[model samples]
Target: MSSQPVPCKNLHEWLSFLEGLHTSEIDLGLDRVLTVFRDMNIGKIAGCVILVAGTNGKGTTIAAMEALLQSAGKSTGCYLSPHIHFFNERVRIDGRNMSDETWVEAFERVESHRGQVSLTYFEFTTLAALFIIARQMPDFALLEVGLGGRLDAVNIVEPDVSVITSVGLDHQDWLGEDRESIGFEKAGIMRPGGVCVYGEVNPTKSILQQASAQNVDLRVFGRDFGVLDADSEPATETMTDSPVFLAQNSAQQPIPDAPVPVSYQMADGDFVRTVLSEQSIPVSNRLCAIQALALTGVRLDKIDIDHCLSLISVPGRFEVDKNNPKYIYDVAHNVHAAEYLSRLLQATRQRRRGKIVCLFSALKDKDSKGIVSLLDKTVDSWAGWPMQVDRALSLAQLTAVLGDNATNAECLPTLGEAVVRAENIACDRNDTIMVLGSFYAVAEVQSFLTNRANRSRGVDEKGIEV
Candidate 1:
């Protein structure tokens, strides 16, 4: 294959080249990436590295961890996938997206080193992110796994702590059919003799088996550590046999239903209590990130923890627009994430004076029916639009799925039209408009809203006055 001229003009050209470089969108393996990574001699990114893998909550957990570490005066480099707006959002240094020039430089390095080996968009970007982060030599490097843990390109880098946020059946085509099979795929991030934190309440049997076989210092959420309210009993002593105990009682005790100011017990029989202000960010994910980071020898006082956590504002995760007609945006593509969004809606139903109008769409591969059925009761009206992407569901497909559960549905052409239709429906009832489905769905709506807001303020797309 002829090496075409490198797209050194800007980040956009480089990204476009990467999208069409490989035959398939997702080629999940490490051999090709590792070959290029080793050639680049990128070693020991930071003093501590954390690899986060799961069906959901990876982005939010990493965000929380980065914020906490940065709050403690430690420089952090975080690499996340599927940016909502700018490609720069994928690679962040010191909680800020690196400049476009920096990203172009990283991409150039990867292109120069990769001779004939074909790398997918994710693989090439992952390598570039590692290169950029290693050059900065931050105190901590947080890598969010793009796909399944075991064979993902990011897995090529060994992590000090591997965290599995929550395992569910989302990418059945790549990961597996059931939760156990998917759990096994996620468990691939755990290195032997290394520390790992399992954050969800339901610890799958496969995860237990993998942790035991690898002799990993695995920390289960409820068994090894957990959160408790002020009125609850004292922190339970760290269990001796964590995997075995967890296997037997995984479902017995769940995350506390209580509110903030909760005390989180660590694996070493220590407790840290702090009040969390971000209701959108789950308490379990916050505690999981804190516990995982503590194992890396980074500790924060209660006040610092509270301060950092309060500053975390992840986009598209229950992001609210508190204008005249309120709106909530969540990138809940699969059933697992949909469950979380459903619970939040149910809890806040009492405060909503008007109808809950959900503007929703999803990829063709997703379980659109399951998500629609699950959220049917909470959402009084539905507006579906075909997300402008290769894998998105068409208007007919979306309407067909909504037929099963959604009684008041509006099938529209684009996200803007869908939002307008939803607003018209909610205008009479003072309802809230929620944009749900894949990341692409949220991106479209957010871009539209942002541009509209800017136009209303007499500002152009470049942020210049009109």
Candidate 2:
């Protein structure tokens, strides 16, 4: 692939052409992707691949790993799904998005390589991501599973370390309804003798059985490692006003162990030490994600961890826009993620004085009712909109699931209108507005916010009114 950019007459035309490939939105099978991969010779790429699969926390885990590796000064490539703002956000190198010219070249390569086999939208994009990553030849690559790991397109590449962040009731239509069924599908990413890490609070026995059967070197959080708040210490004599904390590892130490006091300046020392000492590879960003990566055997120094954590930024995940009435935008589309949002709202409301106004939209296949039921009581008002996508649930369909309990419910056809209405209803003093449900919703609102910010010129860099 040459650096000379591939000239496209129109970007929309290219996008439309790509979108016209498959009839079904999601067709889970390995045959089509495998054929394309074989033709393109994806297996020849020389680097360690980390395949991350879970109902939720997949993006967070991948982001953490990418940050850690980059901080270690290693060239890293990452491919995540359902881009929040831009299509390029799905693929990144050393934490920066791939150039449009690079994407165009990749698309062209995929088109040529896909001789007789027809690829789905995801399959096409997955190939494009791999093409880009292969060109870079980074030391490490992190691939986030777009769906269940069993037959997802990204699973075409065998990973050295397979990480299942957490499994819950999600993608039930395709995977299964119960935890065991879901766990089995996610466990598909594991290879013989590969390091498998589970971040779930309570992992099912089926997952363990599959790991054992596959002969995977498995590590589970809580059972193998855990994190807790360090005990408070008195003000230091030298610092005059400083609090200290410590991090300990049970595997490295025995019982009746005493916690060490970490300097206030080095608050994340314990996490950094744990990550560096545990992982085989030297990870860079120790502070932001080292704690999470520590469970998988990646380590970093205190300074490196701090730098990585400081540089990390994940859009639409607890992203706050503080205008006169604050707006909290989050991409919590699943039931488990929704529950977490509900807990956040409950906790925030306890300490702050505000009325929570929820603006939600979701795909037809998702557990819309379950998600809404989780936040119904916590929110002061509810507004629903159907996303501008093929699988989006109509407002009427959503209302049916909401039932009689959604007395304050109102329908808005477009996401723009829903956001405006939510903002209008919120008072300047203490009211808060939140946009959740689907990535589509957040993407649309983010575009609106960007445009609004550009036109006003009064908005801050964070896209908030001054």
Candidate 3:
């Protein structure tokens, strides 16, 4: 390692320095990273930590939990991977980005504690986030897994609750080649006597096996507690078509009968209620977070939960920018995420008149073909870009994956140019634009859109109001 002060006298410099170290993109061993943590005495810190891992819905789940906790007046710290717009967005306390001085101090602390053991860029950054969390000593710390759970650096922390939110085929090269293999890796996040929550309705057998072997208290969505309908009202008629039930009994509880056809809003509310109740969480939003927090014995009222859920927001995950074409941005790069996006698009299509234009790109490591094939039928127009990020595929590779599709597929060298082209093509007021594929692609387009919106709002070129 360079052992030098990060450049630019800012948090960005520290991030840049960390990124510059180690040519390897991913080193899945724990010894080197553990040594740095052990040397820094991070394990001795006082805080309730929750580690979230899985192929899809992890970010959304984390955001909901964080928001619920914050609403309850808890001092919260959240660390997310592969930032969307700014590196600072990765490490946040109570929804605010960390300061430059905080980053410098944390980097110095990690460097001082390291004794001969080398750390990868991720390891270094993970340690920094831990250092910040330890210092802040927030009521709770939410750590999003950078990759698979077992050997990931975040595994070092013995969380009170380990949540695996819907496993799928992602990171096949390192985790495994199939769903079972990926489930095993995600199961690594569970600790002895710790509570394990599976957001997926039916997880693979391997995940259950690993949890049983670890003797972790496992909570599966459909089997444990469940959601059911209580009663129907006209006000909630359009919200949900079906009334969901939260069954407390795990054994021999017959599934509830399907409700009369109703509105989409009621159906969604029913689903949310089912999920929250199945997890043994209270009906209120504060309880939504408190359910997860209850594993650690923290209790809060409904008002508190409502407060937290209202304040928390997960960026670039279902974030919509109200431009002329009305861009909907999400960081859905994998197949499961693509499926979710497909559902969202389908729902929007019911009310909207214009075609949905998709701007897509991804790293070479991802299952590009499978993801594209799934999206091919959903999107009306396709714009591809291969920006020079780590392991980003070239335009040729992206075009080859499209393979002469009927959709309007074009290769744009840069994300900025791609967004401009997409906007121009989506000139009609009824059209909607979606930019996705990689977090980097989403971030690049977000910056462009934010600037464009600012310009339209009469903000000066320098990003300041007149």
Every candidate's lDDT: 0.82, 0.69, 0.69
Off by over 4 Å in 3: 1-9, 229-290, 304-312, 322-325, 404-406, 451-466
**For model 1, which pairs clash?**
none
List TM-scores for all candidates, in order: 0.91, 0.81, 0.83
lDDT of 2 by residue, 1-466 (tens): 2123335555445567767778777899999888877887766443778888988777777777787777666788899998887688889898899877788778887777777677788899899899899888888888999998988999989887788877778889999999899999999998887767776447778889988887887766544333323554422222333232223322222222242222222222232222122221112112223433443345444334544544555677666764433877888888777766776676557646788888888888888888887788888887777778878888788767656545477778777788778877776557778888888878877777777776689876576767
**Per-residue lDDT over 75-163 for candidate 3, one digit per residue giving the tens place of the 0 to 100 score:** 88888887776677778898799877887888888877775667888999899989998888988889999999999988888887888
By lDDT, the better pick of 1 and 3 is: 1
Residue 310 lDDT (model 2): 46
lDDT (Cα, tens digit) per residue for candidate 1, span 1-466: 2245584598888888998999999988889999999988888898889999998899999999988887788999999988998888998889889899998898888888898999999999999999999999999999999998999999999999999998987999999899999999999999998899998768889999999999999887766555543454432233323221222221223334544444444545565545554365776688788889877767665336766787778988888765543778899998888878887776556567677889899999999998999899788999999988989998899989898778778788877788889888878545688889989988888788888988999998877998
Query: Which candidate ranks first by TM-score, i.e. highest?
Result: 1
Instruction: Flag regions of model 1 displaced more than 4 Å.
Output: 1-7, 229-278, 322-325, 428-430
Worst 10 residues of 1 by lDDT: 242-251
Query: Among these predicted structures, which one has the highest lDDT?
Result: 1
